[model samples]
Structure formats: structure tokens, C-alpha cells
Target: MSATASTQRPRLGVTFWLLAVALVALYAILVPILAALYGVSVPVAFLLGAGMCAAPLLALWYPRSSVAVFTVAAFVLPLTVSPDRDPVWPWPWSVPALILFALFVLTLTMQHGWRLGSLALLLGLMGSLAAPLLLPDAASAGAAGADLIVTASIATVAFVVGVLLAGRIRLGAELTREREHAEFERSRRELVEERTRIARELHDVVAHSMSLIQVQASTARFRAPGLPDEAIAEFDSIAATARSSLTEMRRILGVLRTEDHTAELAPQRGIDDIPALVDSTRRAGAPVDLTHEVEGEISAAVQIAVYRIVQESLSNAVRHAPGSSIGVSVTTAGDDVQVVVRNTPVPPSDPGTPGHGLRGMTERATLLGGEIHADRDGDGWTVSARIPRQPAATEVSATASTSTSTTTTTTTTTTEGSA
Candidate 1:
């Protein structure tokens, strides 16, 4: 699981094809010459040289086994080859075999690690070196002097070179993995830092203003002379609502409360608070008629979105159409919560452009796997939202959900948008 899985076998590249061709040429050219010099049948010479050529390729799968076969053939061939054949070609070990044996040692060393390769080098040298001793007169190059040295040197060099190259390849691969891991960690750290910065800024600016509002509202009764009981209660409600908003904002930003501040853990306003909202708006000058019909359990996220959308709609209606009767309805249909708010139609007093409040409502509805549609009806502007009862796993679900309301002007722009 640490590495990505490969589904198919890798294809052999051009390097492998070229190596195979070189091995075949060695077989075709050397077999006839070896047969003539070995003083043996063509089949015998072919078989002996074949093991040397095949050993390098087979070393990929069975390194020790190929080494054993190559060693046996190397030992037997020197004894069978005629002593008086030729002095020009290397004695005991032919040139083709010398090349092939070195290749075998290199392949074994790289693929199977240096331990097995060291063992193979020792075994190969043993058979080739002992051939001259066994048939002292058959050493066409003066009794195992130069030929023995040549074979031993070639093998040792191959092993040493193979070890160095293999180590380099392994080091490079390890470095690549380490670099990728470091980059991933750095990106994650940057994301966390950015989120913290955003939260701090919001707390410094927005939290400060809300704190002032709550304090002023809470102390209004003391500042005013002989305030009525109902007026005092309304100011207290405003203070309590402000405090609740501050607590919720802190929770959302994941900011810890200080020693002077206590975590309120207040519940958000939901369906039950709609009547109070209507009453407050009526007191503000806009008369609102509200009806509620909720069924099944609704997620806190969906409830909050519904409440905000309603709150914003009412505020817009009151601001733009004071004394106008606003109709608000909350109901559930199967797996969704439905909200509809309609305000009395009036020729838009301002330019019919979408405002921040309208955008906020659209964003809230869209945040939970929901859609909001705000358009003009014959009588007035209607702002409706359909949000799922259960919250979605991610905001991706919100994007996937359908919505016609991107940013409608709502109550402020009655001529062009919804309320």
C-alpha cells in the first residue's frame, strides 16, 4: 500500500532487445570456431558455449543456479579443447566465453546483491584456474599463466563495477520518495497556517463589533429613564441574541475562549424561533404572517440555513416594503425541508441589482445539499429554498445539487428579483 500498484507487467525496452541480439551473435559466431578448436562435435561445442551465453540472461531469475551451470561448463571445456589448436586465441577460456562470463558476473551482482555475486565470482575462478593445473600441457598459453590471470581479473572488475552502479540506482530512488514526502508535508502545513490567519482576522474585526452591540443592548435599560417593561424585555432579547451569535462564531472559527470569556454553547435559532422573528419584524413595522409544518428530524445545519434565509428575507422585506404583509411558510416534503417567503410587490426603489443579503441566503441554502429559487410572482417576490433533511458529507454535494437562484435581489429589487 505504500507504493502505487502496477496493474500490468512492464514491457522489455530497447536495451534488453539489443542485449539479446548481442548474445545471439556470440552464439552463432563462436559455436563453429569453438567446435573446430575444442576437438569435439558441433553439438558438444554448441551446448558448452550455450551455457555461458544463457547464464547471464538466466541470472535474472536464478542467479546461483546459472552460476553453477556456467562453472561446470567452463571447467569441462578447457580439458576437451585441443592443446595445439591455436596460440593466438586465449587459452583455456575462449574470448567469447571471457566476455560472456564477465557479463554473467555483472548481471548476477546487480540483480541478486553482492553476496551471491561474490560467491559466483569465487566459483567461476575456481574451475577456470584449476583447468590449467589438471591438464598442465593443454594450456596453449604457457601453463595457466596469462589466461588464468585474465579470467580472474575480468570477473572481479565486473562484480566491483556492478556493486557501485546498483548502489547508485538504489540511492536515487530513495531520494525521490523522500523529496515527494517532504513536499506533501510542506503543503499541508501551509494550508493550516492560512486557515489560522483567516480565523484571527475575523475574530479581531467582526467579534469586536458584535461585542459592542451586545454590551450596549444589555445596558440600555440603565441608560434610558423609566423604560417600559416590554421595551426592557426587547433590549434583553437583543443582548441575548448577540451573545449567542458570538458563541456560534467562536465555535465555527475553532477559537478557544480566554479566561475572562465563558463558552456559552448556546443552541442556534430554528423553527420555534420563527414566530419570535415575525413578532420582532412586526414590531419593526413590517407585518408578517408565519405558518410551520415540520416533519421528521432535521439536521442542525439545514435548520440554521433555513432560519438564516428566512431572517434575511424578512429583514429585506421590512427594509424595502414597510407596512406590507409578508407571508412565510415552513414545511417538510419527504426527505427535504421547504421554506417560502413572499413580500408585497412594490416598484423597486433602488437599482435592481443583487445585494449582499441575497447572496448570503443563496450561499446558505447551497452550502447544505440544497437549492434556492428567488423569482417574481404575479402578486409579489417569492424566495423559496429546498434543503435536504439530513446533512451531506461535504460541500461537493451542495455544488452537485440544482439551483436557479445564484444572487437574486429579493425584496430590495422587487422589479427584477425575489423576496
Candidate 2:
């Protein structure tokens, strides 16, 4: 229970006490009147009158209208049979009781707050005690004045205490509701954040790898006629790469809630992975032609970009025009790697086909500060990407050797061909 309930408990105790006092007071006032009118003894009259207070208690325990109604009834009962009742007009003790009952009834019906009915009932007690004083009889005035001061003061204190207690109860209930709401919002926010993180990781992983695979597959198809066994080996490598990429992607997303604190898994495909990508698509039935002009070892970031551009274009060819031939070219010029992929026009294909090939490629190229274009070029669809590369040892070797001795170049090409 809240503070309101705790405080209200004492008020309840006081109300009951006041009720007892009212019964006794009315009984004391009635004994003389009953004895004079009906010749009954004081003891009998008092005993009989005291028994009437129980009616109000019963009503209260049963809770008919409001506790105040029963309480007022208890106070009013003695006024009805008082032998001092004047024929012209009775001592208006019943008026205060009625007023108390009305106030309680209103409070019960409206129930706006704690003040109205409880205070009204307390004031009624005061009014009842003061009634005889206003009659101008010295003895009656003195007795009524003393009685009113004592009883009203006690009842008023009880009413005020009850209101304070009730207010506390209301405050506690409001706080509890607010606490629950805050907790719910916190849980919901955590769920949203978790989902967003998963999405970002997925986008980073799948798009990059898929683009590399597509480009390598295109290269393998183009070089297959010139070199068969070597190209076939590349195809096998491409399959393994694809499967590995798929596996890593799944693992990253799987252990989201568990924190093992491992270093982030390195992305499986970089720029160098393009050869395997082209090889895979060639084996998958889309004939891809690839040519590369690079100085030497391209930077990993630049390699990844070139890989994605060729990959997306080739993947688009396979998806949008399944049997179409694709052409891929990569030129690493100083600070940039330019890659272009063009495929035969797709015959009227189904518009509803769902393929992530294009989206994956686009996401990859964009991440590396590169751009891709897919449009109609004469009789086929063409995709192109330009990526910036950092100068490295492999870049110098790849570029310088392309222009030098034929034997060294052929041997070098053959070696790259074998790989």
C-alpha cells in the first residue's frame, strides 16, 4: 500500500471512534427525555438508546450507500425519539445528519477527490453540536457549545488526515505506471539497435564478396579458350571462394547476442580475388571475357573495388540475360583502377525475377568511392566502374612487364594464366 493507504487507516480508526462518541452523546442526551415522557428509568432508556447505534455500524459494515450515510444515520437516530422534541419544531440535530448523508452521497456519486464528502460529514457534526446553543437557553447553550467544540474538532482532524493519505496513494500509482513505460521503451530501443547493426554488417559482407565473384567468373570464361586446364582450376577456386564467402557471412550474423570478443573477420574477397570470380561465372555457363592492365600489386582496397565492379556486371549478365556473353576489362592507371563489364542484350526477360546481383555489385563499388554504370550499349547491356588504386610493388611489376620483352611477358602471362 502507498502512504495514502497508511494514513487513511488511522483516519478510519478515528471515524469509528467518532461514531462511537456520537452514539454515546445521543444516548446521554436521550435518557432524561425518555424517562420524563414515558416514565422509563434512566438505565433502561440509556441501554435502549445505545443499542440503536449498532444499526449504523451494520449499515457501514454492509456498505449500502457510503460509510458516511450509515454514520449520519447513526447520529440522526437519537434525534427522532428524543422526548425533549418540541411540537412546534424539533431541535434540528437531524438536519446536520441529513446534510452529512447528502454530502457523502454526492461524494460517492462523483468521487472527484477525498475532500468533499469527508469534510462535509465532519462539519455536520459541528453543526449538530452547535444547534442547541443558537436556541438562546443558557444551560442548553453551554452544554451544546462544549460538545460541539470537542466532537467537531476530532472529526475534522480525521477527515483531513484521510484526504492526505488518499493523495499519497494516487501519487504512488502514477509513479509506478511511469516506471513501467520507461522500461518498455528501453527494451524496444535495444531491439531496434540490434537489428540495424545486423543489417549494416550484412550489407558490408555480402555485397563486397559477390562483386568479386562475378568479375572473376567473367575473366575465366574469356580466357578459357586460350587456356583450358588453367582456367578450369580458376573455376574450382571461384566455387570455393563463393562457398567460403557465404559461410563467413552467415557466421557474422549468427552470434549477434553473444560477445566472444574476437577480432573482426577479414573480408574474404579483395581486388586480387577478381580472377577467381571471373573463373566461377564462366564455369556457371555465362561466357565471360576478361582483360587486365595493372602496373603491379594493386592496393587491397583498390583490388576490392575493381573486383566488385566486374563482379556486379557479370552477375547482372547471368541473371538478367542468362545465356549472354560478358566482357570485362580492368586498367590500373597510376592512382585509379578502371573496370568495365559489358554483356549481350537480354531478350525480353521476366520483370518479377528477384536477384541481388545488381544491388550487391552497386553496394560494393559505392563503398570504395567508386561508381558503376549499367546501360544499353549497342546490342547489349554494359556495366562499368572506376576505382582508385595505391601504387605498390605488384602494380609496378604487372604494368611494366606488359610493355617489355615478349618472352618475359609471355612467360609472365602464362604464369598468371596458370594460376
Candidate 3:
């Protein structure tokens, strides 16, 4: 245990012992006063007071006999201790003490537990009050009654304060536990979601790489017997493709390991890179028809959105319906760019392939304040994406058109001079 806790144990023990001694002392002093006021003989009064003190000691040593002894003495002692030589209707000054004793006994019965040194202290107190009533003197019972009332009132107030404080402590502990549990659950959920997102990213990046590797390896194996030189070239291509894929995969994985993600992500590919995307698809043995109308500069965010939409749509088509003829279109009208990718469905050969391509495409578009629609059109699936464009930075188009006209006039003049 820490030094503080170790120190607290002895302090608490000392406090309990001090309280016990105080209770015994208070009872011992009060009993003699009460007995003298009621004119009891010194010896008898002392004996009676001593018995009251001994009751709690008995209760401390013997738990079973303790409560019974305390209860019976509480009720019988007051009646036995009359105030006057000739007993009268008004009982004695000891009545109030008896009442206090009964209430203390009731508390004992209700608050019973393994160790209650505090309650034992209170019992000794009640026992002390019983001494005066057993005396043979004539005394005013009203004053004694007032003292008992005051003592009981103070105890009741203390009990209320204690209960309120305890309730507050218990409530605070419960809230702390609940908050900790919530934090734990939140962390667990985030871990699961991060793993799932990484899996998706890995599939998208590595699948393309693996496909290239597979094609090259197959070509090398098939050409080995017929063309030795070409087969070696194919093996080299396979190794290069695998290495490229490995590099790209590392770059993608690194994005997930940091708090600042801007450094980890590659520059976004966009509509301008559509030619490259088409070339890749064509190399993969898919027919791609391209339609381009947007010529103006576009925002990086919008371009990225456009690129992702097309990328996901084409990826889905290639995986779900290979060898399908795809038509890709891009058009910009004022402040908006629209993309459409449609592919004719291929004949089903492979089984158990489900469609998540459309969902991925939709997720990309929706994240960028754009919308994508993928639906069946006759014998094909068509995906259309519309993204809002950013405003132009400058009127570079006007300057370019004016320069082109000047060049045309100059060319005409030169032609006339040659003639």
C-alpha cells in the first residue's frame, strides 16, 4: 500500500478508539449528576450507572446477547428509577432517558452489521442517561425530557447529512464507469471500421497490379517454347509490374498510419487523366469509347471527384462484366461537369461475383457533393455522374483565342508574300 493509505488506517483506528473513550466518559460523568439530582444513595446510584456502562461492553464482547440486554434494560430501567420517595402519576425525570435508550436500541437493530463501533458508542450514551431516574430524589422531569429531545434531534440531523453525501459519491462513481465503458466501445468500433476501409483500398490498388502480373506471367509461360527472347521480356515485365504494385500499395497503406493524412495521399487524378485510364482499360482487353467536351480548367476537388467516379465505374464493369464495350462521356456546361460511363453486359461465365462496384462509385461521388446513378439500360449497366464545377480563375480562354486569330492572319500574309 502507498504511504498515504497506510497512514490513514492507523489514524482511522485511533479516531474510533478516541470516540469510544469519549462516549464512555460522557456517560460516566452524566450518570452521577442525574443520580444526585434525584437523591439516590451514592453506592446504589454508582452501581446502577456502572451497570449501564457495562451493558455496551457486554454488547461489544457478545453480539448475540447484546441487543436483547440493551432492549430490555432500556424499557425497564426508567420505570424502576422513580424520582420521588413516594411514586406519583408524573413518573420520574428518568422517562426522557428511557425514551432515548429505546430509540438508540431501535437504531442498533436496524443498523446491525459485522462491526459498528459507532453504534456501540451511542448505546453507552443512552445507558448513561438511565442513571438519574433510578435515584430516590424529587426532580423536574421536564428538564431531562428537553435534554433527550435535543440529543435525538442532533443525531437525526447528522444521519440525514451522511446519507446525502454518500448518495452523491455513489452517483459520481456510476457516471465515471459509464463514461469509461462508452469510450472503450467507441475505440473498438473505430478499429473495426479502419480495418474494413483499409481492406477496400488494398483491393482496389493491388487487384490492378495483380492482374498485370498474371497476364505477363501467363504470356511468358505460353511463349517460352516458341519464343525464348519474348518470354524473357515478359518475365522482366512481370517483375517490374509487381514492384510497381508493391510501391503503390505501401504508399496507400502509409496513408492509414498517420494523424495528418494530407502527406500520405497521392495527388488526385481527374478528367484530364481520362486518356491514361482509357489506355489502361484497353490494355486490359476492354473496348472503351471516349467522348470529351469539357476543355476548361477545373478545381482539384471536382477533378478528383470526377476521376474517382469514372475509375470506380470502369473498375466495376471490368470486374463484373469483362469484355463489355464501354462508352465514357465528359461534358461541361457553365459551372457543372457531367460524366457518363455505360457498358454492355458480358455473357456470364464465372459464378458467384456480386456487384459492389456501383456502391463504391456512389460513395465517391456522394462524398464530393456529386451524384452517381447506376442502372440497367436494356442489356447494359449505365453510370452517370454530375459534379458541380468551380468558377474560373482568369479569362485565359479569351487571350488564347485572340492569339490564335493573330497567328492565322500572319500565316495568310506570309502565304500571299510567297505567291
The candidate scoring highest on TM-score is 3
Ranking by lDDT: 1, 3, 2
Candidates 1 and 3: which is better by lDDT? 1
Tens digits of per-residue lDDT for model 2, 10-119: 63575557666765565565556555543446665555444433433333333333454444544444443444344332233333333333423332222225545454
Cα deviation of 148, candidate 2, in Å: 9.4
Question: What C-alpha lDDT values do all the predictions have?
Answer: 0.68, 0.51, 0.53
lDDT tens per residue, model 1, 285-304: 34567777775677655665
Global lDDT for candidate 3? 0.53
Evaluation by lDDT, superior candidate among 1 and 2: 1
Residue pairs with backbone atoms closer than 3 Å in model 1 (clashes):
410-418
Candidate 1 achieves a global lDDT of: 0.68
For all predicted structures, in order, the TM-scores are: 0.47, 0.39, 0.53
Error of 2 at 342 (Å): 3.1
